[model samples]
Target chain A: MINIGVDLGGTTIKMALINEEGKMIDKWVIATNTIDNGKHIASEISKSILKKIRQFGLETSSVHGVGVGAPGFINLDTGFIYQAVNIGWKDYPFKAELEQLLGLPVIVDNDANMAALGEMWLGAGQGTRNLICVTLGTGVGAGIICDGKILHGVSGMAGEIGHITVIPRDGAACNCGKTGCLETVSSATGIRRMALDALDYIDSESILRTMFETKGDITAEDVFDCAERQDPLSSTVTEKAAYYLGYALGALAVTVNPEKIVIGGGVSHAGDALVKPLKKYFRHFSLPKIADSCSIDLAKLGNDAGVFGAAWLCMQK
Target chain B: MINIGVDLGGTTIKMALINEEGKMIDKWVIATNTIDNGKHIASEISKSILKKIRQFGLETSSVHGVGVGAPGFINLDTGFIYQAVNIGWKDYPFKAELEQLLGLPVIVDNDANMAALGEMWLGAGQGTRNLICVTLGTGVGAGIICDGKILHGVSGMAGEIGHITVIPRDGAACNCGKTGCLETVSSATGIRRMALDALDYIDSESILRTMFETKGDITAEDVFDCAERQDPLSSTVTEKAAYYLGYALGALAVTVNPEKIVIGGGVSHAGDALVKPLKKYFRHFSLPKIADSCSIDLAKLGNDAGVFGAAWLCMQK
Candidate 1:
């Protein structure tokens, strides 16, 4: 039987028809109509699902169920969206509404959790049951898989690794109103901020300074490019970011002790330059037992991880 | 049917006959007798089990199995003692030996993990399926319970929260060869060290200073006593230790996000003097979503947690 997967994001809603083997049969994306306080989102998703079924000439009996990975604190038991700041959804009965509209079983969870599950099922963590999947984009987000299940804490706030107090004191302020979170040091935005901060002290020979002078703003990719070329200022910034990222992973290693830690998102594309130094700091911080056993690898599926994970959720049910 | 629960420690072995409901029917303690390369330890435990069975006039079929909570790293799947430093067991086939002696099933796990299970089964964590049980004795050890199961990582070393590097830079050296580990700041030894360090700058009129001046070496209990009376130096030391502990818990709250954090061991006996400050600092460090749901409380079962947890292990089998 085929499963329908919905990856609900702030900008777009990506849907896919996934087979039992976790391969996508067909996929489509629609603009996230967040207007009207997201009132039409459930109906819009339902219409898209119906159209996809009709277009594929598939019977409802062939479809297993619908699984959604939404952005926010999700109540797995009720499929209620407690809060999705960007989508303006609060205490919305998303799962029940969509189930009623489509007359099918619906499973919903946090988007990052879906990505983690997706990676675990079909990507870097293929054989691992215990894993941690971290996404480093605008902010750092993580989904913890312990013994092959998502660790949704008491309030569905488990895996808030981004907000763990990394700096301990006098660090960058986070959107969460916390200081010195891992997100403030390890994300793409954090890397650029670090590069911008270094510009004031960097010498004229630094490529990072030249990029900032010419473009007015340096991207995280530019910083990685400069570091790859052995630019001193950029190397320093990348090392610092990698250090914090690795340090946070080390902390997680001792806490959850996952078999594998999968790193994903835009910043992870820096590849070896990012992972090499991160491993160095990880070894320095983790206990010997954990350091020796847990392997860190890049997420292989990229953006498709969410839909794949969403489909996996349906399969689990 | 009854289960035999063994709480193995460096100094003594506490054995109990626990019923299906987890109540201790009969209990006894014996010297650990770790001499002669620890070869006789298992035999002694086997002898005690047989004697208990005969004395109670119980048939072998009436006993479920044996469960042991041993110190140091354990290979849960194989029941191999990787290394119990004090017990002098390294890569020993502990479960096979015990099972052969008693002709019954045997299960073994880390002492801390067992305590966590015990607490969840019948103590402070009785109602919570997801919990973190932290023991703050000479060292800080934690057992992470997720969905009613102990989170044994790839190497069965998942709950080593003690070794999580809390002090990023130059902190106290830990026995694990790490600097600034949570154990260095949150454990009983750490609390005493913090109190001793405070002696250098503590005012002459402070009761902690007077205690230190008279006693030469103050105990953790003495520090707590002084703090209870509002002694400045003791209060400062407790607050510092509590801050580090709460900070570490805050990190755990986001990572594991257990339903409840049950604090046990020697230092936790300080009661409100410890938990109140810890909760305050935890709030300061955790995201409001996590801080609001996770409750930190003292462990209820105390020393009995290990035996109870061991019995619970047998019940699982």
Candidate 2:
């Protein structure tokens, strides 16, 4: 069956037409108009989807349904968004509005959950019933899948991996109002912060200093690039981030016993630079048996995971 | 239908005839024959079950199946005990042996997992689909129930909460050959060790000093008893254990977002003394939304959770 997957983000809405085998039939992106608390989001998305359908000469009858992943606390059954601060939505009947406009069944879940399903369905964790996808973006997020489905806890607050305290003592403050969360150490932003903090080290030599002096600031990519070039200060920063990320992943592995952990988000582009030390520290912190059985890998699907996951959600219904 | 539930332990084997509604029809106990690597256990268990059947004048047809809760690394599907050191079993075909002798279908799972299912079925976590049961006995063990089924992970290693590190620095070692594990602080033995170590505190006014001077050693119960009588040192020890437990549970809440967290085993007997401090710390560490949604309570079935869980397992099939 053909289905439409919508990935609603703050900057853009990614919509994809996916077929029965999960291949993308076509894909489109539309600006997320945030004016007036996103009142026009449903109409915009519906129009875009219909436009794509007509262009492909596909009848509305050929479309099975739509699945949308939004950044919010959502009601899994009714697809209601309790709140998505970035999108300026609260108590929005997301599914009903879209269904009314499109005249089809729709399924909704949190964006992180959708990405995890996408990874499990056809990416790094492909064919694995039990998996965890950790996204190291500007901030950290995780999606836990067990028994071939997402784990949404009582309040859809499960997979808040970034908020878990790795430094249970005095650590850097996080935007979430907590101190020393995993997000404060391992996210792309966290790596950049750590790199900037290391600039005053007593005896350190690094290319990052020159990069910072020239560019005004260094990114997480600069740290990985410097580390690969044998830059001591940047290597130290990467090692510390890897240590915490591995430790948290180790804790999660035993908590849910996932078969594979797929690292995604923009920061995962560091690839082996992140996965190598990550595997080392994850094994160091995990139970010996679990550390042996669970595989940690990099995500392959990149930005398309959400759309794939959204489509997969519609197929489930 | 009537079925038999078995709780296998190092000291004895507890076998109970449980009805379809989970009521215990009759119970029997037999010494665990750990002689020669538990070679006689299967035959002994079958003989005892047959004797109980004759006592009730029940035919073989009346019993539908048998479910056993064993302590060890188990293959849930095959019911193979990889190794249960205390019971001296290794690579044992538990299901086949029991089914061959009793002429009935049999299922087996780790004891902790069974206790969790039992709690979900008839104890504190009754009817809750997403639940976590943390058992604080001689060691810490956990059972994770999500989506109304036990999460076995990929290798039956899920729910090893005890092994999760709480103290990331120099701390006490655990039986699992790890340091700073939650098991080193939250288990019954851990509490006893903490109380003993606290006795050397200068200017301490705890009655625990007198108890240890007279009795030579103190149990965790003595620590709680002393605290109830307003002993400062003992109270401090209990508080510390409660803090670590609460912190770990809070992290776990956001990981899987269970509807309830059931604290069981010997340490849980401290009741409100443990739950109160635990709740405070749990809320302190957990996301406000998750803390508000999930409930932390004591286990109701005590030791009987194993047998009830075993029977519940049989009913599921």
Fraction of native Cα contacts reproduced by each candidate: 0.81, 0.75
What is the lDDT, from 0 to 100, of the residue B119 in candidate 1? Answer: 94
- For candidate 2, write residues A1-317 as lDDT tens digits: 79899999999999999997999988889999999999899999999988898999999999999999899789988899999888889999989999999998989998999999999988999879999999999989899998898888877888999988898889899988878899999999999999888996534556899899899999999999988888888888999999999989878987888889999998898878888999999987889899888899899888999999999988888
Per-model CA lDDT versus the true structure: 0.91, 0.90
Clashes of each: 0, 0
DockQ of 2: 0.78
Instruction: Please compute the TM-score of chain B alone for each predicted structure, in the order given.
Output: 0.98, 0.98
* Candidate 1, residue B159: how far the Cα is off, in Å: 1.1
Candidate 1 matches the true fold with a TM-score of 0.97
What C-alpha RMSD separates each model from the true structure? Answer: 1.5, 1.5
* Interface RMSD per candidate (angstroms): 1.0, 1.0
Backbone clashes in model 1: 0
Q: Which stretches of candidate 1 lie over 4 Å from their true place?
A: A201-205, B201-205
- CAPRI-style docking class of model 1 based on DockQ: high
